[model samples]
Target: MEKVIEMKGITKVFPGTIANEDVDFDLLKGETHVLLGENGAGKTTLMNILYGLYQPEKGEVYVNGQLAKITNPNDAIKLGIGMVHQHFMLVNNFTVAENIVLGREPKKGLKIDINKAIKDVEEISKKYGFSIDPKAVIENISVGQQQKVEILKALYRGAQILILDEPTAVLTPQEIDELAVIIENLKKEGKSVILITHKLKEVMKMSNRVTIIRRGKVTGIVKTSETNIDQLAELMVGRKVNLVVDKEQAKLGKEILRVENLVAKDSRGLNVVDGVDITVNAGEIVGIAGVDGNGQSEFIEAITGLRKPESGKVVLSGKDIYGKSTREIIDSGLGHIPEDRHKRGLILKYSLFENGILGLQHKKPFSKGIVMDYKAIRKHCKKLIEEFDVRTPSDEVNASALSGGNQQKFIAAREISKDPELLIASQPTRGVDVGAIEYIHKRLVQERDNGKAVLLVSLELDEIMALSDRIAVMYDGKVVDILDRKDATEQKLGILMAGGSLSEAKREVKDVE
Candidate 1:
């Protein structure tokens, strides 16, 4: 195999931290190589050094086995390196073709050749099998489609070594499978790809070679065929890890959360959650499974008191909580792990200690007569950070500075700390690494075992099957069916999620509940 690029003796430092330390990495000419590490494990720093965002203190870079000095992004691009960030950088008002050919637009006699650019974009889309509509505006397209536009941008700029950073974190499972196929197609066209992700499963299945990094050092590099998931995990963590969640049979008790004829509407007066009824019993987890937009958000919002139901009852602990404020619901023994951490979970600018005590600040040991006790708050955050294994340099750090998984763990630690009777854990492991996913799952199940009622909502069916005692399939503004984990197959659950029937599965859930 021909080496396209080699990063030898790479060392990068920031204020109070060494981001990358004496790292050696290589990318082949036509291979889908993977960068595997836990959150804050120097993966992004190493790639940024490669792409010229950071100047290494002591290192050398090579392009096609020739030494090169990349001082900026433009220099990296000139060396046939293009990177697509986890968040898409595109003008929403611009058309897909326009976004793709923004800088390198085709022009005719001092005028932008709009038609030619569209034609070129369409050709590239078809050639790469990306299936993007060049004329569609970026704001109107799905995340998956917008990603195609980003790839098209790289392709238009004549990039051979493409870097994708956590590209599938926000995509649906079906979309992830489609992305895998597209990657295969890219490889078939002889384009080398470098995927930076923490999901071990994707790395195991997609990459030809995997490089594991931990604590600013290269732990190991192994061929994908020769490395099992366990080996990769151990190398990444510097210790052995159990990939599967371990839990015994749940000893479920009486219903702690009951929903009767739940009807909720969006701002447009559309019935997003219509006539749904469900129950979550003590010491058990009942997961609501669905795609991204099919009433799941509204259902959780209504139940958690973010939005009041149009006409229904969200009975928590035998009391109607439909019209209560979020704070009141929290006071009423509901621990909600919101889906969007930045939007609803925390104030990003605040320190981790402050954010951890936001919802519980008024309680004793956190506050005293409208004055927050700073020492107590710091103590709380420090304890949870150590207990939850959040990979922050310190608990006093700003919440925004942490990585995705660390932010997630911060939220998880706070929610579980509430020690509420009924917990609403929504998408607890989304955007986290596989190791962190296993850890979070263990924590949630431990909560369940402590005799708490857990109402879990997730888009991952595998997660629903793994953790939930019973699964409620939500589709098109209704509770289509609920089923036990023992009898629910992926095939049946998929059909029910798309508004099909799960008759036998429903019978078992009803009997158990």
Candidate 2:
């Protein structure tokens, strides 16, 4: 196979970190190559060097068999290379066509040619088998659609080599399926692709070859046809990873949290969570399974005191807490692992030790009436960093400096350390690597075994099935059905997630059987 892109001896260094070390990578002309690694494992750094976002201290880039001198994104684009970042770079207020052609606009008599831009977008979208509205505003579109616009933007710039960074991080199962189809179409069009991800399933399903990176170095490269999940995981983490979550049957106890007749509105003042009723008992995990945007976020926010419920009774340890402040709720034994760790969980600018005792700043040993015990705080945070296996150079660094997995580990450590009676973990392992997921899963189960009530809200059905004792399917802001772990299957949950009745889901499962 002909090589479309190659990086030889790529070495990139930051102020205190060697992002990539003597890395060699190559992409075949029409193949989907996966760059597999854990968070902070140098996958993104290598791709950034290739995309001209950063220059390697020691390396040579060969584009289509020729040495390339690419120093900027424009240079890379001119060389027929494009990259779609994990976060979309589209202007939200502009239409899809406008965003796609923002830099290289077609012109007509000293004015931007809007009609031609739309036509060009439509043509490229159709060629790629994508169904996107060229005139639709970016803000009004779904995250999945915004991703499509990013891809269309790259195609519009005549890119033959595409790099997708963590493309499926925020997508639903159906959206992931759609993206798989889109990648297939791109492959059929003979465009080479580089998929950067920590997901083993995606690598197995989408790529022809896989390159594993760990601790800033290449560990192994193998054909996807020959490698199994276990081998790939071991290579990526440098250890044997227990992919399956292990836990014994739950020993149910008294009710820890009860939500009755809950009704909540979104930011636009529309009812998103409507009449949700559920209970989490001590020593059990009650998983909320649903497609994204089904009022799950609102329901969690309402119960956690992040948002007020219009009409509901949120009782924690037999006390009403619906209208209580977040701090009060926390003081009342509610530990929340918010979905967006950066926004709700931690203050990015603060040092790790400061964030470690964030909510507890006003409490016992760490502080005494406005006098914080800095020595004690540092000792406590250092223990947490070690206990949770947070891979950071020092606890004095800003929280923003840590990788996503490390930050999540820190939050998990802090929340679990509080020993709250009721722990509400939302998307706890969303972007974490397999090793971190293993650790987090084990911790959640350990909490459950220790008689803590856990309310888990996740979009990953497999995760829900693996961790929950009782699974509650939410649809259209309602608890459509709740099933025991033994009674649930992916087929049944899939039907219920799409708004089907419990009986209908059962029938579908029966038909499948």
Candidate 3:
């Protein structure tokens, strides 16, 4: 096989971190090559050097067996290399065709040929079996469709080599399956792909060859057929990793949270969450399973007091806490791990110690009579760092300085340590590595065992099946059905997620209550 990309002796460094050190990576033609690593392990840094977003301090890049100097993204595109970032960079207000043909568009004399651009985009999408409306606005489409637009944008740019970073991070399971097929189609067209992700299951399902990197150096490169999940996990983390989540059966207790006839509107002033009811008991985990944008966010926000419910009784330990101030709700025994960590969970610019006591800043030990207590705050932050295994050099460092997993761990430690009666963890392990996922899962289960109510909301059905004592399926802003752990399967969940009737979904599960 011909080598499409060869990065030799790559070394990239930041002010306080050695991102990549003497990393050698290569991708063969017409193959899906995976780059596996822990968060901040220099996987993205290495790929940025290849994509010309960042220049390595020392390295040599070869494209199609020839030396290449790619100092900018334009240079990379000219070399038939296109990258789809983890966060889609499309302008939300622009049409799909317009976004795809932004820099390189067909011209008709003095003006851009809009029709030509749309036709070109439609043709590429059709060729790859992508179901995307070329004229639809980016924000108007579903997240899965938006992802397809990103892929279409890459294909329209005449790319022979594509780099996808964490492509399945925000996608539903069905969308992930579709993306796998799309990658296969791209492979059939003889395009080389380099996938950078920490998901071992995806690596096994998609890659032809797998490269494991740990702390900025390549650990091992092996054929996908020869490596199992255990081997890949060990190689990536530099230790033995237990993949399965170990926990005992739940011992149910009294109800900690109850919601009745909850209603909420989305940003567009539409009723996204309508007539929903849920209950979570002490010593139990109630997981909300649904596709993204199915009113899960609004439901969580209403419960946490981030958004007020239109009409509902949000009873926290027998107290109606609906429409209460966020602080009031928190003081009423609620701990929230919000869906958007950067936006909702942490102040990125603040130090770790500052963010550690964010919601608790007004309370005792952290603040005394409105005077900030730095000594006590620092002590608590240091304890959380050690107890939660947050990998950071010092508590003075900004929260943004840490990796995604570490930031999440910090937030989890902060919320869990407060020992609230009810804990709401939303997408707790999204975009984290397998090791971090394991740690977070154990903590959630621990909270349950300690007689705290845990409300888990996630798009990953497997996660729901593994963690939830009772599973609530949501569709179109309503709780379609609630099932016991034994009655919930991926197939039945998928049917309910797609808005199928409860009876139809229950028919698929033999022992349903």
Give the Cα lDDT of each candidate.
Answer: 0.87, 0.91, 0.91
Q: Write the per-residue lDDT of candidate 3 for residues 1-513, one digit (tens) a residue.
A: 999999999999877779899999999999999999987788888988999999999989999999999999889999999999876899999999999999888999989999999899888988999988889999888888888888888888889999999898888888999999999999999999999899888999999998898888999999999989999999988889987778899999999999999999987888999999999999999999999989999899998888978998899998889999999899999999987888899999999999999889999988899799999999999999999888776899999888776788889899999999999999998778888888899999999999999999998887899899999999999999999998778878888899997688667665654
What lDDT score goes with residue 400 in model 1?
87
Instruction: Give stretches of model 3 more than 4 Å off.
Output: 509-513
The predicted structure with the larger lDDT, 1 or 2, is 2
The reply for model 2, stretches above 4 Å from the true place, is 108-111
TM-scores of the candidates are 0.91, 0.96, 0.95
Better of 1 and 3 by lDDT: 3
What is the Å distance of residue 300 in model 1 from its true position?
1.7
CA RMSD, predictions in order: 3.6, 1.7, 2.2
Backbone collisions counted per model: 0, 0, 0
lDDT of 2 by residue, 59-88 (tens): 899999999989999999999999999767
lDDT score, candidate 2, position 198: 86
Worst 10 residues of 1 by lDDT: 504-513
Q: Highest TM-score, which number?
A: 2
